[model samples]
Target: MVDASQFEKLTTVAKADGVQQLVVGAVVQHEGKVLLLQRPDDDFMGGIFELPSGKVDPGESLDDALRREVKEESFLDISAIREYIGSFDYESGSGKKSRQFNFSVDVRAAEPIELTEHDAYLWAPLHDDLPVTDAVKDVLQKYRELRAVRRD
Candidate 1:
């Protein structure tokens, strides 16, 4: 479980770093695979694979935003946010300077996926070279590294 006790610290760090928008991303894995979503062809960053992610609502804590975004985008409820892998900076669809905080999470179930914001979803195996943006791929790489260490 993630504690909102880190909320002030995260926001302060973001503010200090001049991040205009804060987004939360989840690396949701079940079995030996992590979940990936394909963006709509007409949407921003279209036709690319990405982790379930979204902007954090004002006043929403990081954990809350991550879980909500995963649920809303992938229809999967996060049971636990296991680790905070790291973050990456990028420009948003509206050109806002954005930073996405990434985490490794576990869903209650990996089935019954209903993608509302994307066209497709997949349970990408960790052993494969994933087809995602450089930033997302880095996050997933870090997640895999962390998970491997934990399991050791």
Candidate 2:
């Protein structure tokens, strides 16, 4: 559980800098496949494949925000939000300059997730062929690196 005081401190810092966007995503893996979500043609990064994620609410801890976003977007209860994979900056098609924090998470389960903020979802094989945005790719590269080390 996150501390209430820490949340307040984070909220203060976010407000101080006028940070408008801080998003989090899960690099959810099961059976060697990673989860991917697609934005609708009308939305930012439309037609691009990416991990399930969303904006962090004020006073929200990063891990808590990650679990909430994954649950809301993918309908999966996150069992754990693991190591910090990395972060990347990007400008969505809508011109929203945002930063995305990525992590490897374990999911309790997943179904055909309801698409409210996304157009589609898939459990993609973590291979070179999987279509994904550069931001997601950066996160995946880290996942791949960690995976290799574990195999050693």
Candidates in order, TM-scores: namely 0.95, 0.82
lDDT of each: 0.88, 0.77
For model 2, give the 10-residue run with minimal summed lDDT: 1-10
Off by over 4 Å in 1: none
Per residue, candidate 1 scores C-alpha lDDT tens digits across 56-127 of 998888888898999999888888887788899999999999999988888888899998999998999998
Query: Per-residue lDDT of 1-152 in model 2, one digit per residue for the tens?
Result: 23456444554664576556777778989889898888889775588888988889876777789889988887888887666677776665456666677778888876656776888888898876779866677789889998899789
lDDT for model 2, on a 0 to 1 scale? 0.77
Task: In angstroms, give how far residue 101 of model 2 lies from its true place.
Answer: 0.5
Runs of candidate 2 with Cα error greater than 4 angstroms are 1-19, 92-96
Checking candidate 1 for backbone clashes, the offending pairs are none
